[model samples]
Target chain A: MSARLACFLPLLASLAVAGERLHCVVIEVPSASLPLLREEMKRAAAPVADHGPVLLSTDGLPRRVTHRGQAPFVPEKPIPLGNGPREGSPAGARSFNIVAASGAGGGLVYDVSIQQSPVPASYYDFRTKGLVAAVPANRWQELAAWNQGTRSVSLWHHLQTDEPRAAAGDELRIELIFASMPDDALAHVPEYPPELTRQVVGHLSGTGRVWKSFSLACRADVPFHLQSSHGDRRRRQEPGYGDRVLAKFQGRITRDTPGHATLDGLLEAPRHHEGDAEAYPVSSEASIGEWRLIVLRDGPTFKAAAAAFHEIYTRRAHVAAKVNVVAIRVSVADEGEP
Target chain B: MRCPFLSRTSRWIGSALALTLAAAPARDRLHFVTISRGYDDLLREEMKRMAGTPVLPRSGKLLTGITGFPRNAGYQGTIRLDRDFPLEWSVQRSGTPGRTAGDFGFTLGVMRAGDGPGLRFDVDALESGTEHDFYRMTAESVPLPLGRNTWHPVAAWGSEYNQGMSLWCYREATAVAASTATGIHLLDVQVGFLPEPVVAAMNTFTPEHTRLARGAMAPWQTLSVSCQVDRPFSISSAAGERAMRGRSDDRGLCRLTGTLTQNYETSFNLKCQWQPPGGKKQPQVRFDVPLQPGRWHLQPVEGGPRLRATGPKGEVRVANVAAFRITAAEP
Candidate 1:
């Protein structure tokens, strides 16, 4: 199948009644080559009718998923796709199924099952058990380790309970499949670029799935000396400096989903290394060792993006003895399309 | 031998004439004149009543006159004096029912009457006593006039301790032929205390006698003095002193400018000093001028020893002998 037909097949299969309530099962595909995968799926005669994958492609097109015997439901608004899966319960009632498929490029997929329950419950309640059960037996050990680790994942949940019910008091269940993880999927992890530090001040350039083009240039200066008191033995032994950093990001975002975006970066300094010793009273000398620009999103407005920058840098105590995000500038492309 | 005989005879004749003249006694006559200048009939009657005699002229080798001297209201008296000779004079309170204790003074002097006249002799007697103790005595030469019949001021006296008395005496050149009185004459007599020099100075600047406004720095304020003094003196405000020079008109007028700088309600001591034309001593006179806010007028009471400034609200006298007041103008 061609890339366009592959993107449209999920929409054709999921046509359903607008007001009908039903249980849903969701599966996440980890792949940037969603169009190529669609050709393979067609040749293999996979069950695309009952389990059509919702492709979140870089083309910025909307995809739909519907239940049997129901009319097609199209989203009235653009949905943001790259971050994570979205799930919610209705009035203490729980519903859903989830499954994640791992890809060759170390991209993990999540599978979820949802049931139409009378009382509302959170998906976080079954995070460990349900997720562990959904994984293939051979990958169970790897999934368990990832769950136990400190790495963060990006997942989004959105719940809508206003639709009409098929029964007088019966709750509805809806299923959704998220495929084609964006090239920027790794950027969604809360603490990305782990153990990776860039220069104290440098330029950042990356393409976003939602925002087609992205570039960030920044210069940071240590305006004040960060001295730890002698009474604070830990800080005295490991002194740090505070900094005032300035950053500017320019990019173009899809016009339909325009809103505020965020930029996150990391700053790190080394502690004195003693000879074969883990700790010491004081280090010989220290400097800002690294700075990493993890993610930059085109926010709705420049002011909003700058405010987000200020909010992040001001609250961190370890960035320096003191830290200030002095200036921030964000400019949106005037093309108005993507 | 013959010339000696003639000289001895002439000497004997001159010696006999000298002996005859030496036996004669010196002739001195005391004359008195009654002054009617600037007096009313009521005052003359009051003076007559106080003197226990009619205000009449007494003629003798020494003429005596009973004249009315005006002081404050209810203070009028008779002054009895020898017209040409220096003599003693006394003023005993009339044993009247409403008589009040007061001060009085008498001044007798002889002065030359001419373009460049001068006082030859002057005597002054002042007393602040009751009916029994108030009296004055002076023996001075009568004033001589350089011109015939030229009237020259001779005596001046006043009292305001209890009741007011302002009296003056003048000698006409005719009096010089009547009696051999050759001494200083008093020119002006004021019964009450002298009007504060500053107050008098301000009065010359404006009849309203308005006090300078506090912090009034503007058109310079100028005062002209026409008193009898001959030399220039100095006047000062808080801004400091400026010398007052005599006007070119030779009217004995000294003009002073009060350059005001700031608001001052305190007493300003205006000092004036000058040496007599040919005298070695410099007499310095100071007046305490009280400064307040308002319009003022110098009120010289006829009898009292208090110089007062009458404003729209009321009157204020120099309460302290050392200081007078300057009040603010009426709004």
Candidate 2:
């Protein structure tokens, strides 16, 4: 009895891991343009696949299609396909259908049912006979949320060619849908911290790419807000109309060795406007480090500040120093207007 | 004892003859005056008092041949009529071939008193023939309606062969009933050369059509305009249209510098013209080589129009020829 229980325990653990579902998106493209799509996809991080049938369980959930000869049938109504073969039909276990329609121009359109599970590796294999690109369920959910909040997401397929070319007749079309977040779950999300909100002003020094890398760690109790106001000044000074302020902040940097560095920061960008005195905290990490800050500014004020900072840093170490001003404003929350 | 009716007719005829002789010299020496709105109440009374009266300064010569009009009223005190050519005066128009004529052209900068069709005027030049037969050379009549307070520069030139002629810049205030009461007020006036025909053409010339290339190009575009002018001028782009004033050059070539966008349309305006020296018979041509975003060059097309652009791949032609749009195409 103990030996049998041990084997069953391993099987139960595998089922629990496999049960973890992710959001799966399927894109339909012309079979002929798969090669071109593959070339373009190399620039981005997405897995591509071809045409095939998907299996769904009794609860209308996507299940792994184990056999090739599963009942490939289009149901008039959504039905729960049993786990195994039913009394009469041998393929009654597989439900849901991949409906194909004629797309505008000479292309095929497929109505793919988004699966709740992470797409298996076999789905991306071209040898498995399906054409699609599957994004990890967590990443897909984050992208959808970001797209809903900002409305800045754009999707288009580009044709790869050496010479100047027009849009290809047969191209891939990707459609993304954002799932609404529940109000109760959203309450736990923290608002952007005001402490880190500041206009960073500084300069860069030392030539030749071999400059020493250093980082300034923030206290665990307090959140550090690093922002630059250079973008705002540039927008205002630009001539003509349609001036737009572009603000970008790279959160964290990861390094495998002393010289080699990789930027791995999650971007949490809120809509930025001119004179909006608010700073978004870097991350949830208590102690943030492993970043080399390079600040560049011109004029007498910057020069004097840089010289003063350089004198202090050169005394301690052989590292170059940069002077930066973090302009922070205190909010008068209870102040009444007259 | 004498005939009473004959004596009365002879007395009336002798008085009329004396009045006609007195007005003859006043007609030859005409005064052009410009008044402002500040003197509106005193306009009619002043006009009546100054009529047929010569207002000559005590000293200094009358500025007959001055090009630009004086801005201040104090300067008018220093000028007097030329003593030698006091009766026979000639003023040369500025910026044109100085041709002397007997008559003077004046511009009256007047403002309307009320909201009504202010007035209309007919100007006629008195042409005296060799046999003493006089005829009137009338110019196009202009309307000086209320709210339209502009200096309408009109000219009345007699037959080119006639030597004895006088220019008249006149306006009639009787056209409108309201204007007849207030009368047209003359602010300031000076006799000078008749305005050149080129000046009139410059005011009226509007580019109704343009030819440019459409679609995308590697870089650059060329613009050509065929117009008639007598002097050097420039054509440039303004407010998305070719509306900038170009540098004056005898070469009739204009270099336009501006940044261009991809898949967008821009407009240009040709403001002036350049006429080559001793090339009056030659057609007026204005060429604009716009330096847009990328490298652009005028490709030499054998026996083709002078203005053409070449791109990195091939030559381009003006796509919408009538609308003036240039498009990239294989040469």
Candidate 3:
């Protein structure tokens, strides 16, 4: 009811019996990693590649859903001791530094400091991977939405880890990053890309309900623009499709992944006495449009999640569960493929 | 419906009953919500009302309220300024971590007898005779509401004793800021509870070295400084007058070689004078330093022989090192 009380209520609920294990669900281990703790999934039936991040929803969630961005590990303020040689990961790599949230389940989001990793070769956000955020006015409101039973962040990211015997067992790591909302973008969104609010909710085509909310944000500005190639047209294009119309939406389309993108949604954009055209164009770095929120939540035995994904896409959406982030290992092909 | 005569008699009986109820006054109760400060992170809070030292966890929020104001649910407390100059508000709540932590910054809000929630005092906003000197926050007799829906009256202050140079208070609801002068170092700030005899206990250390600025001294030159007691207060000291002293070497390796007092706010004043390497005005950097209380170290910086002192938590790091800008090697 009160801001103070409301914020604490969920955390309290989480603390109560938060350390429970459900019935075992077998899933493929990172082929490189191996079979999880509980049961095992046949590699043939559970294609790890098809599972992606969206399937972790407990149940009651659609299999195929899109998310813009999901942050797994974020602290109100990160204490940077700034000690030298204190950077990077445990299995050790140097080109980039790793920021850890180990004690909490979330694996550390890599921190790309200008001093350390300047020209990073990541899968998304150009070379850099993360973005800074502004405080939002409605974090409480967003949480209320989750409480109201319409949404849950579990859909976007769900992970469980069956740690080695030396490490503790039954440890689950779920990473989630949300913002109040950004100040600059709130003013900027309605004007330049007037249809973004409607577009994200799938106003154009390929419609679906919001599965599990990945980021509950207020005053959040997660805006980006990606221009693919020439001849990739938008909706209702008249005879005259010039370079300016193509360039106008240059930074409008955004895809954040280390792999190929294939957006499957209706496009919303300006057009004249329209024919069979999308308002926004389907785009990918290569042939055309295909963008989805590159959020990935994994569990130790992600088989149940993989199965859940199959259930959602195949036309069953009554399951309910909160997913989390265990570890997401993206296998990227050569850069030009996307 | 009674007849007119009967109705008149009933009215007389009702009046007599009303007089008896109004004669007895309701007992006033004062419950409180206390916010804790200086925390590493959030933790779970268990509530207890009677203990004098209500072992509050550092740096979090707590709000507790009873049925009435002042007597039953209220407890009195004092805020001693820590070296970090932290200032924030405290209120009681009934839910979640069950508390709300709001950063009042160097300012504070309180509701005393006449003040409720809307009134606030911006301590840093006050200046003495001209509004530019030291600012100590205190309370006023102004009554205001604490929350939007509850228009209860209250008297409040930030965190003041009787003494202060001056204080500025604003009722958040009225949107009006007011200033009151208390001339005493301690000021009274009230929100909900008025804890009497509020005393601040803190360490007040004096630095032996002068403050360093950019480009004034040669890169990486070692300098020595002395410390002496300039002021003392509620803080107890082992070395009565010995201000905690230390030094920095050419390589910027600094060690505070004294059994110095803990938690004292350390600062230094800067003035320039010429000094020859071995003269009486010789740099103190090379001297065997004993941190005797009330002892002064004549420090010389670029203005003379370049004197600098390093405090307990040496603010000097590769980050803020002035010389780093010039001689710092490019990695």
* Cα RMSDs, all models: 47.7, 29.7, 28.1
**Per-residue lDDT value at B97 in model 2:** 31
Question: What fraction of the true Cα-Cα contacts (under 8 Å, chains A to B) does candidate 2 also have?
Answer: 0.00
**Residue B9 lDDT in candidate 1:** 94
Best by TM-score: 1
TM-score of each: 0.19, 0.16, 0.18
Chain B TM, per prediction? 0.28, 0.20, 0.16
The candidate with the higher TM-score, 1 or 2, is 1
Error of 1 at A338 (Å): 91
lDDT of 3: 0.22
Question: In candidate 1, what are the lDDT values of residues B80-104, reduced to their tens digit?
Answer: 2224433344343332244343333
Query: Cα lDDT of all candidates, in order?
Result: 0.24, 0.23, 0.22
Superposition-based RMSD of candidate 2 using all C-alpha atoms, in angstroms? 29.7
Weakest ten-residue segment in model 1 chain A by summed lDDT = A170-179
Question: Candidate 3 residues B74-189, lDDT tens each?
Answer: 22333322222323444332222322333111324333322321222222112121221222222222222222211111211111111212111112222222332111111011
Model 1 DockQ, alpha carbons vs. true complex? 0.00
